[model samples]
Every structure is written in structure tokens, then in C-alpha cells.
Target: MKKISILALMMVFGVVANADTLENVKKQGFMKCGVSTGLTGFAEMGADKKWTGLDVDTCRAVAAAVFGDINKVKIVPLTAKERFTALQSGEIDMLARNTTWTQSRDTSLGVNFAGVNYYDGQGFLVSKKSGIKGAKELDGASVCITAGTTTEMNLADYFKTNNMKYKPISYDTADQVQKGFEAGRCDLITSDASQLYSLRTKMKDPSAYFVLPEIISKEPLGPVVRQGDDVWFNIVKWSLNALVTAEEFGVTQKNVDSLAKSSKNPEIRRLLGVEGKMGENLKLDAKWAYNIIKQIGNYGESFERNVGKGSLLKIGRGVNALWSKGGILYSPPFR
Candidate 1:
């Protein structure tokens, strides 16, 4: 008998070689998603002890795509310092903890950012009694900041670039920073504007503190997953795209079922897996996108309900709005 070629053997076993994170997730009966410790409107446990927020929704969206069940996910709360390590060590399948996409993190860390879920900037949160209306006024003031975040560097850059001097107070968590600020450990706290708002709401008197007008740095926040697994990366990436695309085409949780069944628009049809092999391409069920919309919601809905107008955070869309609506939130074509 003739010896079989190595290429022929590989061809016969290609499926096994291609097995990746998705298979592991499915075998575990759920996806392990890393999230913030407890940032309201992003990834905080409600009074009922259920995880709910924009970041949590992103994790749920991916779960809906992979397992067609929103509840098929285990939330792994992590601090900034521990987040990347969790992903790198395979402790979590994906991370949706409002992490910023920066050069060093993107290149050095063994992870890839799926996409920008929230466009934010660094800002100051100060007590109204201080009468400090802007960030520049806090020149010599000590600043409370969260450790192991991009905000630390941005804070130093902002102060130095403005020819200012200040003392730094670093805490291991956002909760600590909040307490430090309340205890007068620092004159003010600084972080991504969205987090500043979230922290403000948790303050002793929410109305007494306000985010400063000046935005010191661009912070494109999004989900992250380990590098070297294109299949898993694409699934995470497109899960987000599905949400944004649904919003762009006016699809919502309230209307997804109807549209998936009867919509004539080609893009909507493809997105809903009513037409085209969109789900097949991702190794998912035909109703993957539909499950996301039906159970979790579109990006706009998630934003509004968690951090935007519909919630206590009340953050404006700003750059997070859909591109057609005059902000920069745009998704790639589903095709």
C-alpha cells in the first residue's frame, strides 16, 4: 500500500485542528466572561444579585450568539490589574469590562480588542462645594485615581502638559477611589468620564459632585479576548457588530422577532440569519443574531437602559451615537 501524504492526513483532521474557544465554551455549558468589580451601568450586581449593565449585556450578547441563551454565562468580576491576566491565563473566555484600547495593551498584552463599545474621555469628578468648575483649576491639588488603568498616565499627561503640579493618590479599585475622595484623601477623583458619572451616582450625595467640562484624553472602551484565535475573535467581534447593525437598521428587541420573520431588507435579513450563511460562517445557529436582539437588545437599547438617558447615569450618546445620527458609532457591513 502507498504511504499517505502528510497534507492528506492534515486535511482529514482539519476540523480538530480548527477547534477553538467556542468549542471549549460550548463544552463548559456556558461562557466565562470577565467584567469590572462593580461599576454601575457597566457591570454591577443589582439588589437582586444579578449582573446587569452595558458590559454585562455585551457578554450576554456573545452568549446568545454562541449558546442562543442569554443566561448561559458565568460573570467573573475582575479589577483592572487582574483583567488581562484572567484572559491571558484562560481564566475567562472573554472580557467586556469597559477596558480602553491603547497601543501598549493592544500590542504588548496577548489580547485583541473586539471593538469600541463606548467612546469616552478622562475627566475630573469634584464636589460642587469646591466651586472648581473645570479640570484646570485643580493644578496643585492631589488627585485620587484607580491603579492599573490608563487613567493614571492620562492624569499625569494632562497635569504636566498644562504645566501643573499635583500629588497622586492611587487605589486598587474604583470603590476605594470613591471612598478616598469622600474621605478627603484627595481634592478630586479622575477617571474616564463615564466611570466618573458612575462613581458620582454611588456618592453619598450624587447631586453634590459633577464631572468636569474638560475631557483630557480619548478613551475608546470595548471588549477584549485572547489573541491567536481568529474564530473566537470573529465571533466576539460580530456579536457586537450585530447589535450596532440592528440599531442602524432600526431593529430592536421589541421588533426583532417580527423583522426576522418578515423583513424584506437584505441586510436585515442577513443580520437576523433569515438569509445568507451569516451564522454558518460563525459556526452558530441561524438565529444567533435574533437571540441577541430578542434577549439582550441592540446597542442603543443597552446604552440607554444602562448608562444613557433611560438610566441614572444619564450619559449622552456624544461620540457613542450611531454614525448616521451624527456620532461615530458605526458597524461594518454584515455581508
Candidate 2:
């Protein structure tokens, strides 16, 4: 009788230990997501209160994977300073904000960048009327920049190496930086070039501003999750991988269902949740990727909808294009 009781207790502990993120998320009924406060094309709340943008869509894809409904997510809008704190405090399960993946952030911040969803570089935006054609022209110019970001350090280093002197009017948020730049407090606004493009589009006289031709630093922005939870980390990482893999496999939102039923490609079938035990291995239902593709589309689709050809941002897919297409976008094999 004593032996049987011990065995039963051990069995229950084993089951609990093996329970993964999918099970916890389903039990919770909603995936908590950290998003940007309002970056326009990256992560913003719509008029109808629905969250939309590349970062928002990444969260929606994770929700779709777990719940089969993209709407089963709670978006917590976080400022640059608050993003990591919210993730650390468990206020959000995952962060899909426009966060730069850096070595210190990965090692010291107790979070892991799942993958680089957007390849960006830091650059400057100046009024064309100022006759500043490139970053080198900004010598002795006052620059508006955001605090608590790698952009600050990059800006400092770039100007120092060029032997230029400039005053940095650093604000705690991007909105404040934009306002300072617009109010003539600073001669130039510096950030990721993609962000500069988005901010320029929002300016009253967008034609007045021109993004400088120099990209100063590499910015591989992506979703992040708390470290030490391998199950949760893998879910976020592989969900991103699924989107990239889907795009690489020629699987779009429109054709996923048909391809799931009839495509002869083994990889496509596996990615679409048609064959193989991929979903089960991830501790999710077999229709996980199918739901994600059907609901959120692929990475290319999200990029086009939020920032590329379809949106007002109208940024070209330069380094964001697929590896086969001469860009750096590549995903690990799904198998």
C-alpha cells in the first residue's frame, strides 16, 4: 500500500512537470502580449480598439496557435522603458514590441529574443530644407533621440568617431523625441530607419523630411519572452519560425487550406499541420500552424500589410526579403 501511494505521487509530479506552455495558455484563455505604445505601422490600437501592426500580428499568431482564435489575446501597450519590466513582472506573457535584440538584453535582461522578425538599421531623419544630405552633414547639429535604447549609444559612438560635436536632446519616449524634433528643439531625429519612415509619414509636412543615406547600426528587432521557461520560449520562437517557413514554402494565407489538403511537398504539408507530429511536439493541437497561417498569414504578408507596399509607411523590403531572394530573412528547418 505504501509503495503504491509513492508511485501515484511520483506519477502526478511527472505529469505536472511535463505540462508545457500550450496547456498553460489554454487554461488561462488569453495570451498576454506586450506591444509598443503607438509606433503607427509597428504596433498601434485601431479605432475599433483592435490591435494591429507587425508586432500585434505576431501576438495574434501566437494566440491563433494556442486557441485557434487570434482574438484570444490581451494587448498591454508598453513604452520603451516599461517593456522589459512588464515582461519581468509577468504582466505580459510575451513581448512582440519593436524591441532590438542585443547581447546585453539577451544576457542581462532575463529575456530571450526568439528570432529577428524585422531587419532594421539605425539612421537619421532630417528636414530636407536643412540641406543635410547625409549623417556626416550633422556635425555640430543638435539631435533628438530616445533614451534607454541602443540608439543612444550608437549615436554617441558614430558622432565621436567622426570627430563631430552635437547636443543630444534625449527624451524618455519616441513620441517626445518626435515632438522635440518637430518643435525645432533638435536639428535631427535619430532612430531605426524604418521607425524614421513611419514617423515621417505621420508628420504634417512629410515631404519636408528626408531619411539620411547612412545606416549606422544593425537593429534585428523581434519578439521576446522571459528566459528560463524553455517551453514558453520554444513556443514563441517556433511560432515566428513557422511564419518564416510558411513564406519560404510558398504558403500564403489564401492557399494554406488547399495546400494542406493537396500539396505534394512534404515540408509544406508538415508546416500546414497536415502531416507529421509537429504540433504535438510543440504541445499544441495538430491545427496549430494551420490556424496561424489561416488567421495571421505569413511573415511577408504581415510585413506587407503593416509596413511594406500596402501601408502608408511604404518602406521597401530591402534586407527583410527572403534569403533565396538575396535578403537575410531565413528560418531554421521546421523538421
lDDT per residue as tens, model 2, 26-129: 77899889987888788877899888899998999889888889999999998788888777656788999888999999997768899988999999999988
**In order, what lDDT does every prediction score?**
0.91, 0.86
Q: Which regions of candidate 2 are displaced past 4 Å?
A: 1-23
TM-score of each: 0.94, 0.92
Cα-lDDT of candidate 1: 0.91
Weakest 10 consecutive residues of candidate 2 by summed lDDT: 10-19
Q: What is the lDDT of candidate 2?
A: 0.86
Clashes per candidate (backbone, < 3 Å): 0, 0
CA lDDT, candidate 2, residue 296? 85
Model 1 ranges with Cα > 4 A deviation = 1-19
Query: Against the correct fold, how does model 2 do in TM-score?
Result: 0.92
TM-score of 1: 0.94
Best by TM-score: 1
> Best-fitting candidate, measured by lDDT?
1
